[model samples]
Target: MDFSLSGLWHEMGLFARLVVIVMGIMSVTSLLVVGERLLVSFKGMSDSKVFASKLASLLADGPGRLDAAADTKFGKDIGYLGRTLRAGLVAYKGSVHGDKDLCFESVARALERQQARELAVLKRGHGWLATVGSTAPFVGLLGTTMGIITAFEKMAASGSGGLGTVSAGIAEALLTTAFGLLTAIPAVMAFNYLAGWVDARAVDISEASNEFLDLVARRLADGPSEEEEEGEESEAAA
Candidate 1:
């Protein structure tokens, strides 16, 4: 009764083998998701930093610089901050010369919508990881139950029940259990880590939106620009 891996593999019945194959697929899918999320998280963070720095510089120059800033390559990137800021800016632009209240409301709605979309993107594939983590063990338990049933069946058939007759089935149960834990531990860890990253990004986007709105408020309070006032005066004189 060799308790080695190859020996156990050979002894696994059809049901046990099917369970192992399913677990292997789950493991591979979890790994791929983890890698993709990590890559996206890191790239988003880096691009957001660049966009933030550029936005700050433009904002410092004055609210008038926002249009140009929004048109920049950085603003068009797929990062959370860039997309959110661009959405708000586009909304503001459409209503800039009209009602200030409407402009602010539009910008706020745009920010909220962009934030939801970005968060949703960040959360993609997270559910599957959670499902794999929570259910893999139970799946393995099902296999173990089947293996135990087979073991007892063999004992009943042989009529001379001994350790040799049942060890293979017990080995299958233990191996499946071990593989389940192996697949689940990393999946749970990755899900937690990625969730935290998404939260942090959300906070950053919220703060950026607030800062942008504050600038807009200041611009509105200042009233119309000198050029607009001059043009109105010329029209009146004509």
Candidate 2:
């Protein structure tokens, strides 16, 4: 009895083949999702660091530059952080004559909305990876159950209790189980890895938003810069 790959493949019944095919499709889908997720997560992480540094520089100039950050390519490339900050900045800058508390509330709301949207973008395709991880094994088990049923049917039809008679079905059952696990393990690992990255990124975005809000609050409390005061005094003298 040959247990080589080719021999096992030859023993696989139609149901086992179908199971293998389904697993193959799942594997391909999971791989694509993993690749896409890695790209998005890495790019977001990289851009976020750049955005943070540039934002610090811009804020050092004063809160007046918060609105201007959105127009720059650095802000645009900063992914979630940029978008979230832009939302708050726009709200803060627009609420000029409105109540200060209202303005702060607006910025916080904007930050929350942008954060949710960006997190959704980061989490895209994660559900599929999770589905594949959880279900592939069960699907394989279904194939194994079918194989066992076929083995019993064959024994009943042949009226013989020989090991050779049942070996083929058992081989098919084992193959499906093997393929199932092979497809599932990587998907589960990738899902966990990507999920962790996303969570960390979310935390970073949230913290950055909080920091931006604090800066905005402090700037508002400090009033206009010396440059603005000097210009006002000059105009009065003129």
Candidate 1's clash total is 0
Q: Which lDDT tens digits does candidate 2 get at residues 34-127?
A: 9988888888788877777877887788766654654455535767787788788788767733676787888899999999999999999999
Error of 1 at 102 (Å): 0.8
The segments of candidate 2 whose C-alpha lies over 4 angstroms from its true place after superposition are 61-75, 224-238
What TM-scores do the predictions have? 0.92, 0.89
lDDT of each: 0.85, 0.83
Summarize candidate 1's per-residue lDDT along 35-57 as a digit string, tens digits. Answer: 99888878888887887777788
lDDT of 1: 0.85
| Model 1 Cα shift for residue 230 (angstroms) | 5.6
Clashing pairs for predicted structure model 1, backbone only: none
Choose the strongest candidate by TM-score: 1
